[model samples]
Target: MVLKTFGWSFAVTALGLVAAVLYGGWTAFGIVAILSVLEISLSFDNAVVNAGILKKMNAFWQKIFLTIGILIAVFGMRLVFPVLIVAVSAQLGPIEAVELALNDKDRYEELVTDAHPSIAAFGGMFLLMIFLDFIFTDREIKWLAWLERPLAKLGKVDMLSVCIALIVLLGTAMTFAVNAHQHGGGHANKAETVMLSGIAGLITYLIVGGLSSYFENKLEEKEEREHEEEEQARKSGKKVTAMAVGGKAAFFMFLYLEVLDASFSFDGVIGAFAITNDIVLMALGLGIGAMYVRSITVYLVRQGTLDDYVYLEHGAHYAIGALAIILLITIQYQIHELITGLIGVALIGWSFVSSVRRNRELAAQEALGEKAESHS
Candidate 1:
């Protein structure tokens, strides 16, 4: 299984390298490969979170996620999205934007740099909202119910997230909208443009994120019902066989994985912007990262790693929460993407080691109990 997984990753990595070479020569290809590893290393937590979602998916959708999802990550989000952002923001036609990117490399870099603050703001706020929603919302977990009880009593309010987003939007607007003289000879109007662009990005995130959350919740509820049904079937002495692929369960699972993938990709895509404004390079690097993440997800499902590492999912979610906060703080500070990635990796790695150690201790305890019974 390990070899098969590695083979798949190797093939994709080779293809990425070849594509980079064809487009931008050996030097460019080398750069992309390095960046890809950096992205993968930084995004290990993403893989863990993705694994939690992918496990609930049926085989067919999981396969689709690995195949078609790669296309979306590599081309749609990484390459096309940036181009679209540039064209729309710079008032250049799509053709003109592409021409500038392909011909005027320096200009392309400048455009992307100019657009970074807004992109960061959008991604940061979107992720923050996700974290806050997750914390406050009730889940099936009994413990969570107790935790959310007070929050729920406050009424049907997701107002905190909304209010936070509004504050961010207002601060951005004010920072950019102030007069130049009042701001001490700075380009007030330009700052305002960046701020307003960020506000637009935040609004876009809210819309998309709200839709994603709604669908995710519905799918999760459906999964819970199926699980309950299976349990009841088992109690009645019926053979509760797993359903075939591509059923209602499978479709919901697919949606769940897609949503999870999007969430995990948020940081990676944003971080890719920090490396190179060349959409091609960003695509190549982040595509490689996405492939590795998918491969890791598949391996976890096949091996039932989540069952073994019980705390792994918890750790990943915690890391996501931390990352969301970090991204928010970064809006006003020069927080490095590498730092963010490394911190997430460290936290997840610690959890993984702890899980392994705990498993070993349990096994030892069980063995000792069996020996004691035999002696009696």
Candidate 2:
């Protein structure tokens, strides 16, 4: 199972490292390795949230997510997406942006860095929605009941999450504006840019999330009809053919996943620049880590890990909430990537332990009940 599951991830990681060595030598190799580890550590929560969604997909859709999805992730987000951002933000052509990245890396980094506030605002809002929705919705199993219960209660107000997010975004943007005016010397207010990006993020989430929900509902209805037909056919002693999950639902879900991946990547990309300005090295390293994350998502689904660990999803969502807030704070200040990564890992780690404990208690109760029944 291990070989079959992780062979590709290992191959990709090796290939990324080898390319790094061949291009930039041992020092570059070391940098790439560290960046890769940083990406993985920062994205464990991503894997957990991905597993929560990926498990709902059929085997065919799941394979597509692992295969086609990885290409989009590595090339699209890690490589092309950054260039696109630089090109658009700096009012330069894509070719020019690439040249800037290769020849004048510091300038490249500056353009990208200048774009950070907008990126943070957008991604932070998108992720904040995911965290809010997950926490607000009632669940039979909850990890941190005290905190979660209150959030869930507050969730009773329709659109409360969006309302709160807008408020936060406005406040953060105004702060950025103040800092930019006070410090940037005659530059236009940066808060407007941040606010616009945030609004874009909110709109994006609604459109993507709404489309996914609509398609999913349609798929559910189709499945119900097919199930009823299959039951009737079985009653008539007829063989019912297997049906592949329809493409439409999976397509929307696929789009949703990509957006989610982009939002998650924003922080890692910005944080990586603090480590190294070499876009090539950053991409190679983060791409390798991304491949492993994809592998972990598949492994979680295949192993039924989330089903076994009830609190893991809650933990991941909570970690996401922390990350979203961190992203917002990053607009004005530098938060070490180590602190960011540690906060997420700690939450997920504690939740995993809690889940194990819960399992033990349930097992003991079941065993005692069985023993009493036997005696009776």
Candidate 3:
């Protein structure tokens, strides 16, 4: 299974390399390959988190994630989104902005840099909400139930998340607004725009995140109830059919994967700015990022690694929380994304090794029990 999964990844990686060479040269190929590995390492947590959700989805949705979902990741979020941000911030038309990006690379970089405030604000808040919602909510696993209880109690206050979001909004407003006057005359207006953009980002996070949380919770509850019903049927000696996803469930899964990919791509897309403003280079980097994320999803599914690492989901959520905070800090500080990616890879790698050791230990214990029983 591992070989098969790796075979597919190798094939995709090779295809990307070849395409890069054909389009640009050896430099492009090398860059794409390096960026792909970097993205894959950084996004291991994304794969684990995706597996936690994907297990609830059927095979059809999983395929959609590998197919149509890639389009959104590569083109929609990675390509068009950045251009749109540039256009909106620079007061240029979208087509003109894209042309400028494809032609005048220097200007493109400047525009993207200028637009960083909004990008950081949007991606930061979105990831923050995701991290907090997962951390604060209860899960089926009881390993962290004790920690969850306190958070749940806090959440019972009706609008804890909203209140926290408001504080973040105000803080961003004050920081940018206050600093705006230090630049110059027109610079002050720019600061107001930046502050307002930050608030807009926060508002976007509240709406999308709240709705996603609602649906996620509802689906989880429904699954639990169904599981209970199945257990009852088993107790009654009746055959209980396994629940399979289809139709709307598949659609929802696709949507979930898309959103998840979007979140993961935020860092890579933003970091690509440090490399080159050439849309082609950006696409190469982002495309490689997309390819590896898709490959990781397939790797998890094919190897059934999710079944082995019970704590893997927990680790991923924690990593997501860390990434969120890192992104927020990057707003003011120059946080190298490579550091963030390396940390995620290290954590997930540790979890994987620990899971393997525990599984081996369990197998040995079982073997010892069998041997003793045979002697008896």
Residue 17 lDDT (model 2): 86
lDDT digits (tens) for residues 1-376 of candidate 3: 6555456556656777788888789888777766776677777798788877766667777777777877887789878988887798779998898898888877777777655555666666666666677666666653356676788667667667656765775676566534432111222324455456556656666655555556666677778998999999999999997565556656665665676667677787777766656677567666766666777777776666778776676678778777766665555556777899887877677667767777898899999999999999
Off by over 4 Å in 3: 1-12, 140-156, 176-242, 353-376
- The alpha-carbon lDDT assigned to residue 256 of candidate 1 equals 47
Q: Write the per-residue lDDT of candidate 1 for residues 66-89, one digit (tens) a residue.
A: 788777766776677767767976
Q: State in Å the error of residue 348, model 2.
A: 0.7
lDDT of 3 at 150: 83
Task: Give the TM-score of each candidate.
Answer: 0.76, 0.92, 0.81
- lDDT of residue 184 for candidate 1: 17
Residues 174-278, candidate 2: write the lDDT tens digits.
885445421122344578888999999999999998888898887877788899999999999999975545477777888899899999999889888878989
Alpha-carbon shift of residue 36 in model 1 (angstroms)? 0.9
- Poorest stretch of ten by lDDT in candidate 1: 179-188
Alpha-carbon shift of residue 31 in model 3 (angstroms): 2.1
The CA lDDT at 265 in model 3 is 74
